[model samples]
Target: MAYQTFRQEYLQVPPVTRAYTTACVLTTAAVQLELITPFQLYFNPELIFKHFQIWRLITNYLFFGPVGFNFLFNMIFLYRYCRMLEEGSFRGRTADFVFMFLFGGLLMTLFGLFVNLVFLGQAFTIMLVYVWSRRNPYVRMNFFGLLIFQAPFLPWVLMGFSLLLGNSIIVDLLGIAVGHIYFFLEDVFPNQPGGGRLLRTPSVLKAIFDTPEDDPNYNPLPEERPGGFAWGEGQRLGG
Candidate 1:
């Protein structure tokens, strides 16, 4: 019964979020078990270009190191915000959401080339949180009941928390920059006078990822449901 319940909940997560979180967990587990090493997963431009270790480009974003406080903290935020974005503003828009992921990821990769940063999973999570917060600006949020503010401040609050932990703020800042660029181009500028929709969902992508409406019984799930408000003060660290 417990396994079945867990299966049900797992199936409820949207496809992209489900795949991403699964990959993260599996990658971390592999590292923890000594099956893989961080040296293999970090972003190395020379290795990628010269040695053809191209997998580093994607693997760098999948690892958060062995299980610990940072790993658990990042995973929670990633799962929560990524799921929320998939189920909220991006609802019924799978192709566009996936495009956003690709876009943000490409930008991050470009920026990372110049920075001495590895393991972009934390920054990726921050980007997701930033985009979600921007879209839902009015949503009231609190961090561990100690800090309460609007949704958009969540990313900055997280940056401050990272600072407190003796971690560098560059990753968090990189994420915020990418997220704001996305928001400005896709959401903000497109609505301004003389502005147009520059980020049209490609026809091929729509054809591949979007659901067809011609089918009368193409239910994708137990029915479309909203994500839970799992954020706020009561939630414990590493939860």
Candidate 2:
């Protein structure tokens, strides 16, 4: 009975978020069970280019280390913001969302070649949080019930939390940079004077994942509010 209930809820998540989060969890589980090792997953330029271990490009963003506090923390933020982006502005635009994932992942891989970092799951999670926070700028956030700030400050708060934990802030910075690049190109630039569409999703991606916007029966998810709150009313969260 519990399994059936779980299946129903899982099916209801927006498709992109559902698939990505499931992959992350399963990858971690694979490591936990020792079916694979982090050594096989971490990003390595030589392995990817010279040895052609192409899978590392994707795997480096999946495993978040063994299950514990750090794992749970990153997973919570990842699932929350990823789902929010999918169900909010990205509703009915699965192909574009997938493209954003591809863009961010590729950009991070390019950056990883020069950096000493290994696993990139946490950085990817920060990118999602950054993008979501920007789109829902008016939303209010409560950090562990101690600090209350508007949504725009969320990525920084996460970075600060990372500092408190003694982890490097470089990963968070990388996510922020990529997230900003995406947000600016997609949301900001097109609206500026003389700026036209720049980051359009390719026709092939649209053909594969998006129903034509003009379809007579086409429907988008209903009653979406930025950050899950009405634009005027805004949002308040303890997440």
Q: Candidate 1 lDDT, tens digit per residue, 1-239?
A: 99999997898788898999999999989988899999999999899999999999899999987798889888888887788788777777889989998898999999999888987888999999899888876666667657767777889998999999899999999999999999999999989999977878788889988885424443343111212434432221222
Per residue, candidate 2 scores C-alpha lDDT tens digits across 8-88 of 788877788789899999999999899999999999899999999999999999998899989988887787778878877
Error of 2 at 163 (Å): 0.4
C-alpha lDDT (0 to 100) for residue 21 of candidate 2: 91
Candidate 2's C-alpha runs over 4 A off are 212-239
**lDDT values for all models:** 0.82, 0.83
Off by over 4 Å in 1: 213-239
Q: How many backbone clashes are present in model 2?
A: 0
lDDT of 2 at 91: 74
TM-scores vs. true structure, each candidate: 0.89, 0.89
